[model samples]
Target: MGCAHGKCCNRDSSTSDEHSGHHQRGIRPYKNKDGLTQRSLELVHVPSHNFTLQYSSLTQHGYYPDTTDRENQDSFCIKTQIQGNPNVHFFGVFDGHGQYGAHCSNFVKDKLVEILSSDPTLLDDPLKAYNSAFLATNSELRDSEIDDALSGTTAITVLVVGDTLYVANVGDSRAVIAVKDGDRILAEDLSVDQTPFRKDEYDRVKLFGARVLSVDQVEGLKDPDIQHWGDEESHGGDPPRLWVPNGMYPGTAFTRSVGDSTAEKIGVIAVPEISIVRLTPSHLFFVVASDGVFEFLSSQTVVNMATAKVSYTLDFNACLLQNNATAYKDPSDACTAIAGDSYKRWLELENRTDDITIIIVQIKGLSNQSVVGTTDSEVHSRPCQTGGSMNQSAAIVPPLMHQKPLESVGHSSCSFLSLYIYIYLSHLFFIHCATRLVDLPYTWFLCFATCVIFFIVVPAYIQPLGEESSYYLCFLMIFFSK
Candidate 1:
């Protein structure tokens, strides 16, 4: 348990001299030779582009009950203005595993983004650049003196180019976007986890001669032939792991990662699962975090936490009124809340927590843009496709734009027209009643009640319900009340 790689090696728990404690700040405040800030953690405001992105990140060292002193294997990077392009930005979270996992994570954190930024076709063809950059970085890591035979890091990165987002992921770290559908905010997964739980990944590794089994089966404590694990959430006490057919030297839970030479032979490649999303006003913000945060929490839970409303008091003539506004919270506060929640959950469940890192980016002021390329439904419905080998044209994935809130199913033009007709008929009926009814005040009261129900109660309820059926119900209520 003292070893970072656990059963992979017998080495003692000795922290790296270069990365002792959590001193390595991924977003350092140093300037490069060209006088550009290499990385930053402060608020970023890009005026040239239509949108303004403010981001905050937090990384906490985990509690290791077995070891007195252990270095945090998590690392992250947030670089802005890639290649001097203000509209282009980068954010990544790296969760390292194994003895030298810290070193692998730090090394990849610096080199992978650098290689992608240096590529000339990054803007024109991002998918190809991502494929090349990840593979290149993996090669560099293998050649380096960092003994990544059984050690490596999972990478989840997002590159913002203008209004489009290029999310590339390896391993289980995840990225999720908060999409505002009417009054409700929905969570959308930007990247899929590459693990044995995924049948495609499990099959791919098995084809590469990997013996996928839990430690129980490997130790003869359980049946080796039967597959026990279902999903990550219900994997019980032991999850399925990948190991060599003849040996249990390298047992990696994830299917793809950077470094992990020993595991690479068994199908753990560094090729990233790239996703493209076009930023819209409805895309409020996105969260990129390590598996430590997502291991116990779902993407929807993370998004909900990040976008949770905070109530504040407003003084009006000394009368304190509670205001529960859904305005976006400060990115810094959001990061802290998310990390704290993940930390609490881990300790509550496992007694020890894995290193947790989170990056919350708030997107604002995105001008409505036309659907340029691949629609989100089309891309999301399609199976996960690995990059590289494809031609430049095939590799270039167009931006996936979100459908307008009003244009969604059930809330269409026809629905609005029907609603308008109902309102008009209701008003006419109220007028006819006004002339016939002997009690004019009662008729007026009824009209006022109808207005309040249709305008205030109906919208308030429908916004949270976020369904077309609710709109129709509101129309019916107004018609019957009249």
Candidate 2:
């Protein structure tokens, strides 16, 4: 395989005046050796024999009040037709940290996927291919001109081949899937975070001479010998970090990452934890995001927020009436909601936020066909499984955490009344046009034309107007035409 490296360009140092707006300074177009340009996000449609994949991504710069204007360290990649195969797709999110974090992230983001796409054996043995690609990409990053002695990135990626999904993760970034269980949708974790909180990871790093201690412990504010931190959640005190035994330099919170040369000596590795999941009709969508989004939000909470934007009915008759239409929520809207909510949560807690990036992929067209891939035993052996049974009785969250319903009749009463009045006026104008075009007795032609507009033209505009707007428009059109 040919490994072609890409160089990072100089970025502007100026910060945006609007602190609340989406951070645009960190988004720059990167061109690899193949002359292919990679941007922050790309909107694409991948069609397969059994299902179609639709994806959207969003990134926001964090609020760093203490630093002198820094660029966004979050980077993402979306590639379709991997190795010229239409059934294969790739998506990734990288969260960089340290002084030269941005350059490290962008380099790895471009080269990692490129290496996997160029591999010949990727299709036959995805597990081996994933391991080789990650190790090779780490070596390439270390050889690059970027100074990564103390800086590195966390990567969470997903590769789709036909009906199977291979998720590879390092560091703290995470991937999650939404499984439809009867009437409720639930979130299942695709990757477990590699941090000191995991007992196995902590023991391995300690065996390699790493001293795990929180900032407070390192500063002599607490005892370093005592290991008292609990799991990621409910770890009420300062989180444990890995540092050199003798010095306080190169303290990293994650147990695994790419290009952290100083921390690598203490067992922080670039190897990824790969999970294989077979796509079924019950699998609705999946989210790949940086730790920024999952910092304060639970996996279940994130799934609920993503699904709230999409209105899905569990009734078989309703689905049959609509011809089994899938994807009620646009993926882009879901990305925006996740990013925005994460940004807000960061500001609320620490007054500063981490770079937030999110990618949402919705699975469609699998309802009518049987999905083929790995056996159930292989999938359940890892952290991949439906979350409904686990979180069935999860407590309800406040309305603020959920996405507001799309404005339409029967969904938002205020909007419904306003739309009803607007349609009544439009009906009068159409009746007048009918009278001018033909006799009053032959006005049924106008009603037919109105039906065409409401049924055909309006549905096409539903995405732009909001997904639920079409139903309400059709409802009002029928009432006024009568």
Candidate 3:
């Protein structure tokens, strides 16, 4: 594990300006007691005034002793006006897991952007370049002395050139955009989570004789069924993951990643899912974060939280303008505020937090003048209105609040009570006529059909009501069926 910082450590970083030179010199290289050359790096602070692009990034370590070690396995980099290309802006977030996870993430953070920059095809075909860079980086890691048999990293990158935004992802790290549609803010996921749970990933892995197991499946295995490291029983409530047949040599959660040579044999790949989006004026901001922030929050939750931060900053700026205040803050403050909120929410969800990283890209304006002038009122008023496609006069569906648990307001108490009574009556009927019911010609079929109707079919049909409501319905179905 290594220390977590917001920026990258470049051994050969060129100083283009006075600040770059100062930044380079301020980073002093050191060696640990183990005598390994530690990569000394500083978080690249892109102040709102001087930054070439509109983006902000933050990384925080997980809970307690994990926080104490500061071995944040997440890393990100933002490069604007890359290689004399003024329109090109690149942003990435990498999440690494395993013993030397930090090294893997750090290596990708350092080299991936360089590879992308150097590729001649980047300007001509950005998607191909992004893919090539990721594969090349994976090969580089495999050939290197780093032990990647059980270790690897997940990456999600955003490359915005001109009006086109290209998002490429490998593993569970995520990317999303806050789209202003009318008066509601909508979260459009730009990158998919490449884990075994996905239908495509599951099918592909199974084709290679690999099995995706749930936490319960792994814990339930006996001697011949499976062999795993750590406790034979479940330690913590682990999630569903990819595992090797009859072995748990590399129990990677994700179906796609970089530099897991051993897991590659079982169909784990380094290929990334790439998406291209044409930016519009209605597009509010872009958010890229590791699973740490997402694990405890939904995409909409993140967008709302960030939108709130943007609103707060807008209000603060308005007051500052009124007073003609000398001291001002960068728009990046919105990103820092979101990260702080994420950490607080994580604490509420779980006892231990994973490493958290968030990057916010302001899309409406690239320069300070336009961004600072943009107020909260404009952004908040239209959450669902897209550039030219969507209607403006549509009734606003209130933005999903992330701060608290959701309750179903659409369902009335009377309806719930009636439904409960109906279920109770069915249960009583089933119990009273069990013997007679079994003698009927299609008795087994009837029972199976009824169970499916009450359990699977009904829940799926009413899922639009809300998740909490669906969950309660499922509980009732189970109770009545029993």
TM-score for every candidate vs. truth? Answer: 0.68, 0.66, 0.59
Query: Mind giving the per-residue lDDT tens digits that candidate 2 earns over 59-118?
Result: 666665664255566677777767655567788887777655666676677778878977
lDDT of each: 0.67, 0.66, 0.57
Candidate 1 stretches greater than 4 Å from native: 1-41, 46-49, 310-324, 369-397, 400-482
Candidate 3's error at 425, in angstroms? 87
lDDT of 1 by residue, 276-320 (tens): 876767777889888878888788677767765632224211111
Candidate 3 whole-model C-alpha lDDT, 0 to 1: 0.57
TM-score of 2: 0.66
What is candidate 1's CA lDDT for residue 273? 95
| Local lDDT at 426 for model 3 | 49
Better of 1 and 3 by TM-score: 1
- Quick one: how many clashes does candidate 2 have? 0
lDDT of 3 at 462: 63
Model 2: which ten-residue window has the lowest total lDDT? 382-391
RMSD for each model, in Å, please?
13.6, 19.0, 22.0
lDDT string for model 3 (307-358, tens) is 6423323322111112322111343565666667777876785565666777
